[model samples]
Target: MTGLFTFGETMGLVVADGIGPLTYARGFSFGIGGAESNVAIGVARLGGESCWLGRVGPDATGALIRSRLEAAGVRTIAVPDPTFTGLMVRYRRSGEFAHVDYHRAGSAGSRLNPADLPPSELREAAVVHVTGITPALSETCRAAVFQAVETARDAGVPVSIDVNYRAKLWSRFDAAPVLRDLVGLADIVFASPDEAALFVDEDDLLGNLAKLGPAEVILKDGGKGCVAQIGGERHAVPALPVTVIDPVGAGDAFVAGYLADRMAGAAPEQRLTTAIAAGAFAVTVSGDCEGLPDRAELAALGGGDLRR
Candidate 1:
Protein backbone atom coordinates (compact mmCIF):
# COMPACT_ATOMS: atom_id res chain seq x y z
CA MET A 1 0.00 0.00 0.00
CA THR A 2 1.17 3.52 -0.69
CA GLY A 3 1.90 5.42 2.51
CA LEU A 4 2.13 8.77 0.78
CA PHE A 5 1.06 9.63 -2.74
CA THR A 6 1.68 12.79 -4.79
CA PHE A 7 0.88 13.73 -8.37
CA GLY A 8 2.04 16.54 -10.67
CA GLU A 9 4.70 17.35 -13.23
CA THR A 10 8.38 16.60 -12.69
CA MET A 11 10.68 18.47 -15.03
CA GLY A 12 14.31 18.05 -16.01
CA LEU A 13 16.41 20.81 -14.39
CA VAL A 14 19.44 22.46 -15.93
CA VAL A 15 21.46 24.28 -13.27
CA ALA A 16 24.41 26.51 -13.89
CA ASP A 17 27.64 25.43 -12.23
CA GLY A 18 28.71 28.93 -11.23
CA ILE A 19 27.27 32.34 -10.48
CA GLY A 20 26.43 33.90 -13.83
CA PRO A 21 23.94 34.05 -16.67
CA LEU A 22 22.87 30.80 -18.38
CA THR A 23 24.73 31.67 -21.56
CA TYR A 24 28.06 32.31 -19.81
CA ALA A 25 27.99 29.34 -17.43
CA ARG A 26 30.99 27.13 -18.06
CA GLY A 27 29.44 23.92 -16.75
CA PHE A 28 26.00 22.67 -15.82
CA SER A 29 24.34 19.76 -14.08
CA PHE A 30 20.99 18.04 -14.43
CA GLY A 31 18.36 17.00 -11.90
CA ILE A 32 14.59 16.95 -11.49
CA GLY A 33 12.24 19.44 -9.79
CA GLY A 34 8.51 19.77 -9.15
CA ALA A 35 6.44 20.46 -6.05
CA GLU A 36 4.71 17.07 -5.92
CA SER A 37 7.69 15.04 -7.12
CA ASN A 38 9.98 16.84 -4.70
CA VAL A 39 7.66 15.94 -1.87
CA ALA A 40 7.50 12.33 -3.05
CA ILE A 41 11.30 12.12 -3.17
CA GLY A 42 11.57 13.67 0.29
CA VAL A 43 9.15 11.12 1.72
CA ALA A 44 11.11 8.30 0.12
CA ARG A 45 14.37 9.66 1.51
CA LEU A 46 12.80 9.69 4.97
CA GLY A 47 12.06 5.96 4.50
CA GLY A 48 8.34 6.43 4.00
CA GLU A 49 6.59 4.63 1.16
CA SER A 50 5.37 7.09 -1.51
CA CYS A 51 4.16 6.92 -5.09
CA TRP A 52 4.05 9.53 -7.89
CA LEU A 53 1.52 9.54 -10.69
CA GLY A 54 1.72 11.72 -13.81
CA ARG A 55 2.83 11.98 -17.42
CA VAL A 56 6.23 12.27 -19.05
CA GLY A 57 7.49 12.27 -22.60
CA PRO A 58 8.97 9.13 -24.09
CA ASP A 59 12.33 10.86 -24.35
CA ALA A 60 15.75 11.00 -22.71
CA THR A 61 14.87 13.83 -20.32
CA GLY A 62 11.84 11.89 -19.22
CA ALA A 63 14.02 8.84 -18.74
CA LEU A 64 16.33 10.88 -16.54
CA ILE A 65 13.46 12.06 -14.36
CA ARG A 66 12.04 8.53 -13.96
CA SER A 67 15.44 7.01 -13.20
CA ARG A 68 16.19 9.63 -10.54
CA LEU A 69 12.82 9.34 -8.77
CA GLU A 70 13.11 5.52 -8.83
CA ALA A 71 16.62 5.79 -7.47
CA ALA A 72 15.23 7.94 -4.69
CA GLY A 73 12.71 5.12 -4.00
CA VAL A 74 9.50 6.80 -5.19
CA ARG A 75 7.07 4.48 -6.98
CA THR A 76 6.23 5.84 -10.42
CA ILE A 77 3.19 5.24 -12.65
CA ALA A 78 3.85 7.92 -15.26
CA VAL A 79 2.25 7.56 -18.68
CA PRO A 80 4.27 8.15 -21.81
CA ASP A 81 3.42 11.10 -24.03
CA PRO A 82 4.74 11.90 -27.49
CA THR A 83 5.60 15.51 -26.67
CA PHE A 84 8.89 16.64 -25.19
CA THR A 85 9.50 16.41 -21.47
CA GLY A 86 9.22 19.68 -19.57
CA LEU A 87 12.45 21.43 -18.52
CA MET A 88 13.58 24.28 -16.25
CA VAL A 89 16.80 26.24 -16.00
CA ARG A 90 18.33 27.55 -12.80
CA TYR A 91 21.02 30.18 -12.31
CA ARG A 92 22.58 31.51 -9.13
CA ARG A 93 23.26 35.24 -9.18
CA SER A 94 24.75 37.56 -6.55
CA GLY A 95 25.42 34.82 -3.98
CA GLU A 96 22.42 33.01 -2.48
CA PHE A 97 19.82 34.44 -4.85
CA ALA A 98 18.68 32.16 -7.67
CA HIS A 99 16.47 32.55 -10.71
CA VAL A 100 14.60 29.80 -12.53
CA ASP A 101 13.23 29.79 -16.07
CA TYR A 102 10.61 27.41 -17.32
CA HIS A 103 10.26 25.86 -20.79
CA ARG A 104 7.25 23.69 -19.94
CA ALA A 105 4.43 25.15 -21.99
CA GLY A 106 2.64 22.51 -24.06
CA SER A 107 5.01 19.88 -22.72
CA ALA A 108 4.06 16.32 -21.91
CA GLY A 109 3.43 17.20 -18.27
CA SER A 110 0.73 19.71 -19.19
CA ARG A 111 -1.04 17.00 -21.17
CA LEU A 112 -2.05 15.18 -17.99
CA ASN A 113 -5.65 13.93 -18.17
CA PRO A 114 -8.04 12.03 -15.93
CA ALA A 115 -7.11 8.80 -17.72
CA ASP A 116 -3.66 9.06 -16.15
CA LEU A 117 -5.05 8.67 -12.63
CA PRO A 118 -5.38 4.99 -11.71
CA PRO A 119 -8.29 4.31 -9.38
CA SER A 120 -6.80 1.24 -7.79
CA GLU A 121 -3.59 3.04 -6.98
CA LEU A 122 -5.46 6.00 -5.55
CA ARG A 123 -7.43 3.65 -3.35
CA GLU A 124 -4.22 2.12 -2.04
CA ALA A 125 -2.63 5.38 -1.01
CA ALA A 126 -2.70 6.27 2.68
CA VAL A 127 -2.75 9.98 1.84
CA VAL A 128 -2.83 12.06 -1.32
CA HIS A 129 -0.69 15.16 -1.88
CA VAL A 130 -2.22 17.48 -4.45
CA THR A 131 -1.01 20.84 -5.72
CA GLY A 132 -2.65 24.00 -7.10
CA ILE A 133 -0.11 24.27 -9.91
CA THR A 134 -1.35 21.17 -11.72
CA PRO A 135 -4.83 22.60 -11.97
CA ALA A 136 -3.43 25.73 -13.55
CA LEU A 137 -1.28 23.85 -16.08
CA SER A 138 -4.04 22.93 -18.51
CA GLU A 139 -7.71 22.03 -18.55
CA THR A 140 -6.92 18.33 -18.85
CA CYS A 141 -4.35 18.56 -16.09
CA ARG A 142 -6.93 20.21 -13.89
CA ALA A 143 -9.31 17.31 -14.48
CA ALA A 144 -6.62 14.80 -13.55
CA VAL A 145 -5.89 16.63 -10.28
CA PHE A 146 -9.57 16.80 -9.44
CA GLN A 147 -10.06 13.14 -10.31
CA ALA A 148 -7.14 12.18 -8.09
CA VAL A 149 -8.53 14.18 -5.16
CA GLU A 150 -12.04 12.84 -5.62
CA THR A 151 -10.75 9.30 -5.84
CA ALA A 152 -8.74 9.71 -2.65
CA ARG A 153 -11.60 11.37 -0.80
CA ASP A 154 -14.04 8.65 -1.89
CA ALA A 155 -11.57 5.98 -0.83
CA GLY A 156 -11.40 7.48 2.67
CA VAL A 157 -7.76 8.42 2.21
CA PRO A 158 -6.65 11.79 3.58
CA VAL A 159 -5.87 14.54 1.14
CA SER A 160 -3.18 17.24 1.59
CA ILE A 161 -3.04 20.26 -0.68
CA ASP A 162 -0.27 22.74 -1.23
CA VAL A 163 -1.30 26.02 -2.85
CA ASN A 164 1.79 26.32 -4.96
CA TYR A 165 0.28 29.01 -7.11
CA ARG A 166 2.34 30.21 -10.04
CA ALA A 167 1.54 33.58 -11.55
CA LYS A 168 2.89 32.49 -14.91
CA LEU A 169 0.22 29.79 -15.08
CA TRP A 170 -2.91 31.81 -14.24
CA SER A 171 -4.16 35.01 -12.72
CA ARG A 172 -4.88 35.13 -8.98
CA PHE A 173 -8.45 36.33 -9.46
CA ASP A 174 -9.10 33.37 -11.73
CA ALA A 175 -7.36 30.92 -9.41
CA ALA A 176 -8.88 31.93 -6.04
CA PRO A 177 -12.18 30.10 -6.31
CA VAL A 178 -10.60 26.93 -7.68
CA LEU A 179 -7.96 27.05 -4.98
CA ARG A 180 -10.64 27.68 -2.36
CA ASP A 181 -12.55 24.64 -3.60
CA LEU A 182 -9.42 22.50 -3.33
CA VAL A 183 -8.71 23.80 0.16
CA GLY A 184 -12.17 22.74 1.18
CA LEU A 185 -11.51 19.18 0.07
CA ALA A 186 -8.17 18.88 1.83
CA ASP A 187 -7.68 17.21 5.19
CA ILE A 188 -4.56 19.35 5.48
CA VAL A 189 -3.83 22.56 3.57
CA PHE A 190 -0.50 24.38 3.06
CA ALA A 191 -0.03 27.81 1.60
CA SER A 192 2.53 30.54 1.68
CA PRO A 193 1.44 33.78 3.35
CA ASP A 194 0.94 35.48 -0.01
CA GLU A 195 -0.93 32.54 -1.45
CA ALA A 196 -3.31 32.49 1.48
CA ALA A 197 -3.74 36.23 1.19
CA LEU A 198 -4.97 35.74 -2.32
CA PHE A 199 -8.31 34.73 -0.88
CA VAL A 200 -8.37 35.96 2.75
CA ASP A 201 -6.82 38.71 4.80
CA GLU A 202 -3.65 38.00 6.80
CA ASP A 203 -5.30 38.14 10.21
CA ASP A 204 -8.10 35.73 9.33
CA LEU A 205 -6.28 33.58 6.82
CA LEU A 206 -6.09 30.42 8.91
CA GLY A 207 -9.56 30.83 10.36
CA ASN A 208 -11.17 31.64 7.03
CA LEU A 209 -9.39 28.70 5.42
CA ALA A 210 -10.58 26.37 8.17
CA LYS A 211 -14.10 27.65 7.63
CA LEU A 212 -13.78 26.11 4.16
CA GLY A 213 -13.69 22.58 5.71
CA PRO A 214 -10.10 21.43 6.09
CA ALA A 215 -9.28 19.90 9.46
CA GLU A 216 -5.87 21.55 9.36
CA VAL A 217 -4.40 24.68 7.77
CA ILE A 218 -0.74 25.73 7.51
CA LEU A 219 0.50 29.17 6.59
CA LYS A 220 4.16 29.15 5.64
CA ASP A 221 5.90 32.43 6.50
CA GLY A 222 9.19 31.64 4.81
CA GLY A 223 12.19 32.13 7.14
CA LYS A 224 9.94 33.29 9.95
CA GLY A 225 8.42 29.75 10.17
CA CYS A 226 4.85 28.48 9.94
CA VAL A 227 1.56 28.66 11.82
CA ALA A 228 -0.98 25.86 11.71
CA GLN A 229 -4.42 25.06 13.02
CA ILE A 230 -4.92 21.33 13.51
CA GLY A 231 -8.36 20.02 14.36
CA GLY A 232 -9.20 23.37 16.00
CA GLU A 233 -5.92 23.50 17.94
CA ARG A 234 -3.36 26.14 17.07
CA HIS A 235 0.38 25.43 16.67
CA ALA A 236 3.26 27.58 15.59
CA VAL A 237 6.83 26.54 14.77
CA PRO A 238 9.84 28.64 13.93
CA ALA A 239 12.08 28.00 10.95
CA LEU A 240 15.41 26.33 11.53
CA PRO A 241 18.42 28.56 10.97
CA VAL A 242 20.64 27.50 8.10
CA THR A 243 22.86 29.29 5.61
CA VAL A 244 21.01 29.61 2.35
CA ILE A 245 22.12 27.76 -0.79
CA ASP A 246 19.08 27.23 -2.94
CA PRO A 247 15.46 27.79 -1.90
CA VAL A 248 13.60 26.22 -4.80
CA GLY A 249 12.37 23.03 -3.16
CA ALA A 250 12.32 24.02 0.50
CA GLY A 251 8.54 24.17 0.77
CA ASP A 252 8.05 20.74 -0.76
CA ALA A 253 10.71 19.36 1.55
CA PHE A 254 8.81 20.78 4.52
CA VAL A 255 5.60 19.06 3.40
CA ALA A 256 7.42 15.76 3.03
CA GLY A 257 8.91 16.02 6.48
CA TYR A 258 5.55 16.86 7.97
CA LEU A 259 3.98 13.89 6.20
CA ALA A 260 6.79 11.62 7.34
CA ASP A 261 6.11 12.48 10.96
CA ARG A 262 2.36 12.38 10.52
CA MET A 263 2.63 8.90 9.01
CA ALA A 264 4.48 7.87 12.18
CA GLY A 265 1.69 9.27 14.35
CA ALA A 266 3.80 12.12 15.68
CA ALA A 267 2.33 15.04 17.56
CA PRO A 268 1.76 18.33 15.81
CA GLU A 269 4.88 19.94 17.34
CA GLN A 270 7.05 16.99 16.40
CA ARG A 271 5.66 17.06 12.89
CA LEU A 272 6.57 20.73 12.46
CA THR A 273 9.99 20.15 14.00
CA THR A 274 10.88 17.51 11.44
CA ALA A 275 9.42 19.73 8.75
CA ILE A 276 11.58 22.73 9.68
CA ALA A 277 14.64 20.49 9.80
CA ALA A 278 13.91 19.21 6.32
CA GLY A 279 13.47 22.73 5.03
CA ALA A 280 16.77 23.92 6.56
CA PHE A 281 18.57 21.08 4.84
CA ALA A 282 16.89 21.81 1.53
CA VAL A 283 18.35 25.31 1.32
CA THR A 284 21.89 24.14 2.05
CA VAL A 285 22.10 22.23 -1.21
CA SER A 286 22.00 23.32 -4.83
CA GLY A 287 19.53 20.89 -6.40
CA ASP A 288 15.80 20.56 -5.82
CA CYS A 289 15.41 17.04 -4.42
CA GLU A 290 19.03 16.16 -3.61
CA GLY A 291 19.18 17.89 -0.22
CA LEU A 292 16.36 15.90 1.39
CA PRO A 293 17.44 13.81 4.40
CA ASP A 294 16.57 10.32 5.57
CA ARG A 295 15.49 9.47 9.14
CA ALA A 296 18.99 9.08 10.49
CA GLU A 297 20.21 12.14 8.64
CA LEU A 298 17.34 14.23 9.94
CA ALA A 299 18.12 13.14 13.49
CA ALA A 300 21.81 13.84 13.10
CA LEU A 301 21.00 17.32 11.82
CA GLY A 302 19.51 18.46 15.13
CA GLY A 303 23.03 19.17 16.43
CA GLY A 304 24.22 20.16 12.94
CA ASP A 305 26.73 18.76 10.42
CA LEU A 306 30.04 20.19 9.31
CA ARG A 307 31.56 19.49 5.89
CA ARG A 308 34.60 20.97 4.20
Candidate 2:
Protein backbone atom coordinates (compact mmCIF):
# COMPACT_ATOMS: atom_id res chain seq x y z
CA MET A 1 0.00 0.00 0.00
CA THR A 2 2.98 2.30 0.31
CA GLY A 3 3.71 2.11 -3.40
CA LEU A 4 3.90 5.27 -5.50
CA PHE A 5 1.07 6.00 -7.94
CA THR A 6 1.08 8.63 -10.68
CA PHE A 7 -1.21 9.64 -13.53
CA GLY A 8 -0.11 11.64 -16.58
CA GLU A 9 0.69 11.60 -20.26
CA THR A 10 3.53 9.53 -21.65
CA MET A 11 4.64 10.54 -25.11
CA GLY A 12 6.91 8.97 -27.71
CA LEU A 13 10.22 10.82 -27.84
CA VAL A 14 12.26 11.23 -30.99
CA VAL A 15 15.75 12.42 -30.08
CA ALA A 16 18.32 13.41 -32.61
CA ASP A 17 21.13 10.84 -32.70
CA GLY A 18 23.81 13.36 -33.55
CA ILE A 19 24.37 17.04 -32.92
CA GLY A 20 22.55 18.83 -35.73
CA PRO A 21 19.18 20.22 -36.74
CA LEU A 22 16.34 17.79 -37.44
CA THR A 23 16.76 18.51 -41.13
CA TYR A 24 20.41 17.52 -41.04
CA ALA A 25 20.14 14.83 -38.35
CA ARG A 26 21.02 11.45 -39.84
CA GLY A 27 19.54 9.19 -37.20
CA PHE A 28 17.09 9.35 -34.29
CA SER A 29 16.58 7.47 -31.04
CA PHE A 30 13.20 6.50 -29.73
CA GLY A 31 12.17 6.55 -26.11
CA ILE A 32 9.41 7.63 -23.78
CA GLY A 33 9.29 10.83 -21.74
CA GLY A 34 6.67 12.07 -19.35
CA ALA A 35 6.85 13.76 -15.97
CA GLU A 36 4.69 11.32 -14.02
CA SER A 37 6.00 8.25 -15.81
CA ASN A 38 9.58 9.38 -15.33
CA VAL A 39 8.89 9.77 -11.62
CA ALA A 40 7.41 6.29 -11.55
CA ILE A 41 10.55 4.93 -13.20
CA GLY A 42 12.68 6.84 -10.70
CA VAL A 43 10.78 5.34 -7.79
CA ALA A 44 11.02 1.89 -9.32
CA ARG A 45 14.75 2.24 -9.89
CA LEU A 46 15.15 3.27 -6.26
CA GLY A 47 13.49 -0.05 -5.25
CA GLY A 48 10.02 1.29 -4.63
CA GLU A 49 6.87 -0.28 -6.06
CA SER A 50 5.25 2.24 -8.39
CA CYS A 51 2.50 2.32 -11.00
CA TRP A 52 1.76 4.61 -13.98
CA LEU A 53 -1.84 5.34 -14.85
CA GLY A 54 -2.75 7.01 -18.12
CA ARG A 55 -4.24 6.66 -21.55
CA VAL A 56 -2.40 5.88 -24.75
CA GLY A 57 -3.40 5.55 -28.37
CA PRO A 58 -3.77 2.24 -30.16
CA ASP A 59 -0.60 2.79 -32.09
CA ALA A 60 2.98 1.54 -32.32
CA THR A 61 4.24 4.55 -30.41
CA GLY A 62 1.91 3.73 -27.55
CA ALA A 63 3.20 0.18 -27.57
CA LEU A 64 6.75 1.46 -27.38
CA ILE A 65 5.99 3.72 -24.45
CA ARG A 66 4.31 0.94 -22.46
CA SER A 67 7.12 -1.51 -23.17
CA ARG A 68 9.66 1.03 -22.01
CA LEU A 69 7.70 1.68 -18.83
CA GLU A 70 7.49 -2.04 -18.12
CA ALA A 71 11.20 -2.41 -18.75
CA ALA A 72 11.86 0.29 -16.16
CA GLY A 73 10.16 -1.83 -13.49
CA VAL A 74 7.04 0.33 -13.41
CA ARG A 75 3.61 -1.23 -13.42
CA THR A 76 1.57 0.41 -16.16
CA ILE A 77 -2.18 0.90 -16.07
CA ALA A 78 -2.50 2.23 -19.57
CA VAL A 79 -5.79 2.45 -21.42
CA PRO A 80 -5.98 2.53 -25.18
CA ASP A 81 -8.00 5.23 -26.90
CA PRO A 82 -8.95 5.79 -30.52
CA THR A 83 -6.73 8.83 -30.95
CA PHE A 84 -3.00 8.49 -31.70
CA THR A 85 -0.33 8.74 -29.07
CA GLY A 86 1.30 12.06 -28.28
CA LEU A 87 4.77 12.69 -29.70
CA MET A 88 7.71 14.89 -28.62
CA VAL A 89 10.65 15.53 -30.89
CA ARG A 90 13.79 16.64 -29.02
CA TYR A 91 16.71 18.07 -30.92
CA ARG A 92 19.56 17.75 -28.40
CA ARG A 93 21.67 20.26 -30.23
CA SER A 94 24.47 21.01 -27.77
CA GLY A 95 25.23 22.43 -24.34
CA GLU A 96 22.19 23.29 -22.22
CA PHE A 97 20.03 24.33 -25.14
CA ALA A 98 17.71 21.88 -26.87
CA HIS A 99 14.81 22.38 -29.26
CA VAL A 100 11.65 20.41 -28.56
CA ASP A 101 8.47 20.22 -30.61
CA TYR A 102 5.23 18.81 -29.23
CA HIS A 103 2.59 17.20 -31.41
CA ARG A 104 0.06 16.28 -28.74
CA ALA A 105 -3.02 18.11 -29.91
CA GLY A 106 -6.02 15.76 -29.84
CA SER A 107 -3.73 12.92 -28.94
CA ALA A 108 -4.78 10.09 -26.64
CA GLY A 109 -2.92 11.54 -23.68
CA SER A 110 -4.62 14.88 -23.99
CA ARG A 111 -7.98 13.15 -23.96
CA LEU A 112 -7.52 11.78 -20.46
CA ASN A 113 -10.72 11.68 -18.45
CA PRO A 114 -11.47 10.84 -14.85
CA ALA A 115 -13.34 7.73 -15.87
CA ASP A 116 -10.08 6.23 -17.08
CA LEU A 117 -8.69 5.99 -13.54
CA PRO A 118 -9.73 2.94 -11.57
CA PRO A 119 -10.87 3.74 -8.03
CA SER A 120 -9.43 0.54 -6.56
CA GLU A 121 -5.96 1.39 -7.77
CA LEU A 122 -6.22 5.05 -6.81
CA ARG A 123 -7.22 4.15 -3.25
CA GLU A 124 -4.44 1.61 -2.77
CA ALA A 125 -1.38 3.77 -3.16
CA ALA A 126 0.46 5.56 -0.39
CA VAL A 127 1.05 8.69 -2.45
CA VAL A 128 -0.48 9.85 -5.72
CA HIS A 129 1.88 12.11 -7.68
CA VAL A 130 0.78 14.45 -10.46
CA THR A 131 2.29 17.24 -12.54
CA GLY A 132 0.96 20.50 -14.00
CA ILE A 133 1.85 19.32 -17.50
CA THR A 134 -1.08 16.92 -17.57
CA PRO A 135 -3.58 19.59 -16.53
CA ALA A 136 -2.30 22.00 -19.15
CA LEU A 137 -2.83 19.46 -21.91
CA SER A 138 -6.61 19.82 -21.96
CA GLU A 139 -9.67 20.45 -19.84
CA THR A 140 -10.54 16.78 -19.57
CA CYS A 141 -7.00 16.05 -18.46
CA ARG A 142 -7.34 18.79 -15.87
CA ALA A 143 -10.58 17.27 -14.64
CA ALA A 144 -8.88 13.90 -14.39
CA VAL A 145 -6.12 15.39 -12.27
CA PHE A 146 -8.65 17.06 -10.02
CA GLN A 147 -10.60 13.85 -9.68
CA ALA A 148 -7.48 11.86 -8.89
CA VAL A 149 -6.47 14.34 -6.20
CA GLU A 150 -9.95 14.29 -4.71
CA THR A 151 -10.07 10.52 -4.74
CA ALA A 152 -6.70 10.25 -3.04
CA ARG A 153 -7.78 12.77 -0.42
CA ASP A 154 -11.04 10.98 0.24
CA ALA A 155 -9.30 7.66 0.67
CA GLY A 156 -6.86 9.09 3.21
CA VAL A 157 -3.93 8.97 0.80
CA PRO A 158 -1.32 11.65 0.33
CA VAL A 159 -1.10 13.70 -2.87
CA SER A 160 2.09 15.10 -4.41
CA ILE A 161 2.09 17.73 -7.13
CA ASP A 162 4.89 19.23 -9.20
CA VAL A 163 4.29 22.67 -10.71
CA ASN A 164 5.82 21.76 -14.08
CA TYR A 165 4.59 24.85 -15.84
CA ARG A 166 5.35 25.11 -19.58
CA ALA A 167 4.79 28.35 -21.45
CA LYS A 168 4.28 26.42 -24.69
CA LEU A 169 1.14 24.86 -23.23
CA TRP A 170 -0.37 27.87 -21.47
CA SER A 171 0.43 31.38 -20.36
CA ARG A 172 1.44 32.26 -16.80
CA PHE A 173 -1.71 34.31 -16.29
CA ASP A 174 -3.83 31.31 -17.29
CA ALA A 175 -1.73 28.70 -15.48
CA ALA A 176 -1.12 30.52 -12.19
CA PRO A 177 -4.66 30.24 -10.90
CA VAL A 178 -5.13 26.64 -12.06
CA LEU A 179 -1.76 25.61 -10.66
CA ARG A 180 -2.56 27.33 -7.37
CA ASP A 181 -5.77 25.36 -7.17
CA LEU A 182 -3.87 22.07 -7.63
CA VAL A 183 -1.28 23.15 -5.06
CA GLY A 184 -4.06 23.70 -2.56
CA LEU A 185 -4.91 19.99 -2.78
CA ALA A 186 -1.38 18.62 -2.56
CA ASP A 187 0.28 17.32 0.60
CA ILE A 188 3.75 17.46 -0.97
CA VAL A 189 4.61 19.97 -3.67
CA PHE A 190 7.74 20.41 -5.83
CA ALA A 191 8.58 23.55 -7.79
CA SER A 192 11.40 25.63 -9.14
CA PRO A 193 12.00 29.20 -7.94
CA ASP A 194 10.35 30.62 -11.05
CA GLU A 195 7.34 28.32 -10.80
CA ALA A 196 6.90 29.14 -7.09
CA ALA A 197 6.90 32.86 -7.89
CA LEU A 198 3.74 32.32 -9.91
CA PHE A 199 1.75 31.39 -6.79
CA VAL A 200 2.83 34.13 -4.35
CA ASP A 201 4.97 37.26 -4.18
CA GLU A 202 6.80 36.14 -1.00
CA ASP A 203 10.56 35.74 -1.12
CA ASP A 204 10.16 32.67 1.09
CA LEU A 205 8.81 30.46 -1.68
CA LEU A 206 8.52 27.37 0.51
CA GLY A 207 6.77 29.32 3.23
CA ASN A 208 4.33 30.73 0.73
CA LEU A 209 3.57 27.20 -0.48
CA ALA A 210 2.97 26.04 3.08
CA LYS A 211 0.25 28.64 3.34
CA LEU A 212 -1.46 27.02 0.36
CA GLY A 213 -2.21 23.82 2.42
CA PRO A 214 0.75 21.60 1.49
CA ALA A 215 2.49 19.94 4.45
CA GLU A 216 5.80 19.82 2.58
CA VAL A 217 7.03 22.26 -0.07
CA ILE A 218 10.27 21.75 -2.00
CA LEU A 219 12.02 24.48 -3.95
CA LYS A 220 14.57 23.20 -6.46
CA ASP A 221 17.26 25.59 -7.69
CA GLY A 222 19.44 24.13 -10.41
CA GLY A 223 23.11 23.73 -9.36
CA LYS A 224 22.19 25.67 -6.19
CA GLY A 225 20.64 22.56 -4.60
CA CYS A 226 17.16 22.32 -3.08
CA VAL A 227 15.33 23.53 0.04
CA ALA A 228 12.48 21.87 1.85
CA GLN A 229 9.90 23.25 4.26
CA ILE A 230 8.41 20.36 6.18
CA GLY A 231 6.83 19.69 9.58
CA GLY A 232 7.32 23.28 10.73
CA GLU A 233 11.03 23.16 9.91
CA ARG A 234 13.39 23.87 7.00
CA HIS A 235 16.31 21.90 5.53
CA ALA A 236 18.66 22.67 2.67
CA VAL A 237 20.63 20.13 0.60
CA PRO A 238 23.24 20.80 -2.05
CA ALA A 239 23.09 19.17 -5.47
CA LEU A 240 25.86 16.89 -6.65
CA PRO A 241 28.27 18.11 -9.31
CA VAL A 242 28.36 16.16 -12.55
CA THR A 243 28.89 16.89 -16.23
CA VAL A 244 25.43 17.21 -17.65
CA ILE A 245 24.64 15.24 -20.78
CA ASP A 246 20.97 16.12 -20.89
CA PRO A 247 19.08 18.64 -18.76
CA VAL A 248 15.70 17.10 -19.21
CA GLY A 249 13.94 14.71 -16.76
CA ALA A 250 16.19 15.63 -13.81
CA GLY A 251 13.28 17.16 -11.95
CA ASP A 252 11.24 13.98 -12.20
CA ALA A 253 14.17 11.96 -10.88
CA PHE A 254 14.51 14.34 -7.94
CA VAL A 255 10.83 14.03 -7.11
CA ALA A 256 11.01 10.24 -7.36
CA GLY A 257 14.01 10.07 -5.06
CA TYR A 258 12.37 12.26 -2.44
CA LEU A 259 9.12 10.30 -2.51
CA ALA A 260 10.89 6.93 -2.36
CA ASP A 261 12.90 8.07 0.66
CA ARG A 262 9.88 9.63 2.32
CA MET A 263 7.94 6.39 1.80
CA ALA A 264 10.81 4.46 3.39
CA GLY A 265 10.45 6.69 6.47
CA ALA A 266 13.73 8.52 5.89
CA ALA A 267 14.22 11.96 7.47
CA PRO A 268 13.72 15.18 5.56
CA GLU A 269 17.45 15.77 5.17
CA GLN A 270 18.04 12.25 3.91
CA ARG A 271 15.22 12.59 1.42
CA LEU A 272 16.61 15.89 0.20
CA THR A 273 20.09 14.40 -0.11
CA THR A 274 18.84 11.49 -2.22
CA ALA A 275 16.70 13.86 -4.22
CA ILE A 276 19.72 16.02 -5.10
CA ALA A 277 21.81 13.01 -6.00
CA ALA A 278 19.10 11.58 -8.22
CA GLY A 279 18.82 14.90 -10.01
CA ALA A 280 22.54 14.97 -10.53
CA PHE A 281 22.50 11.46 -11.88
CA ALA A 282 19.72 12.36 -14.31
CA VAL A 283 21.60 15.18 -16.05
CA THR A 284 24.63 12.96 -16.67
CA VAL A 285 22.74 10.69 -19.05
CA SER A 286 21.04 11.11 -22.43
CA GLY A 287 17.67 9.41 -22.11
CA ASP A 288 15.21 10.61 -19.49
CA CYS A 289 14.83 7.51 -17.30
CA GLU A 290 18.07 5.84 -18.30
CA GLY A 291 20.09 7.95 -15.87
CA LEU A 292 18.07 7.30 -12.71
CA PRO A 293 20.16 5.50 -10.11
CA ASP A 294 19.29 2.52 -8.00
CA ARG A 295 19.31 2.62 -4.18
CA ALA A 296 22.81 1.16 -4.05
CA GLU A 297 24.10 3.37 -6.88
CA LEU A 298 22.66 6.49 -5.24
CA ALA A 299 24.19 5.51 -1.90
CA ALA A 300 27.56 5.09 -3.54
CA LEU A 301 27.15 8.40 -5.35
CA GLY A 302 26.71 10.14 -1.99
CA GLY A 303 29.83 8.46 -0.66
CA GLY A 304 31.99 10.42 -3.15
CA ASP A 305 32.45 7.67 -5.69
CA LEU A 306 32.29 10.34 -8.35
CA ARG A 307 33.82 8.10 -11.03
CA ARG A 308 30.85 7.13 -13.19
Candidate with maximal lDDT: 2
Model 2 collision count:
0
Per TM-score, the best of the predicted structures is 2
Q: What are the RMSDs of all candidates, in order?
A: 2.9, 2.4
Candidate 1, 127-240: lDDT as tens digits: 899999999999999988888889999989999999998998899999998998999888999999899988876688889889989997888877998999998999988887
TM-score of each: 0.95, 0.96
lDDT of 1: 0.87
Clashing pairs in 2: none
Candidate 2 lDDT by residue in tens digits, 1-308? 95998988999988998776678888888888999999999999888889998889999999998898999899998898999999999995665579999999999999999899988887999899999999999999999999999999999999999999999999999999999999999999999999999978767788889999999999999899999999879998887878988889999999998998888878888889888999998888898788888877876777212221
**lDDT (Cα atoms) of all candidates against the true structure:** 0.87, 0.89
Q: Which stretches of candidate 2 lie over 4 Å from their true place?
A: 303-308
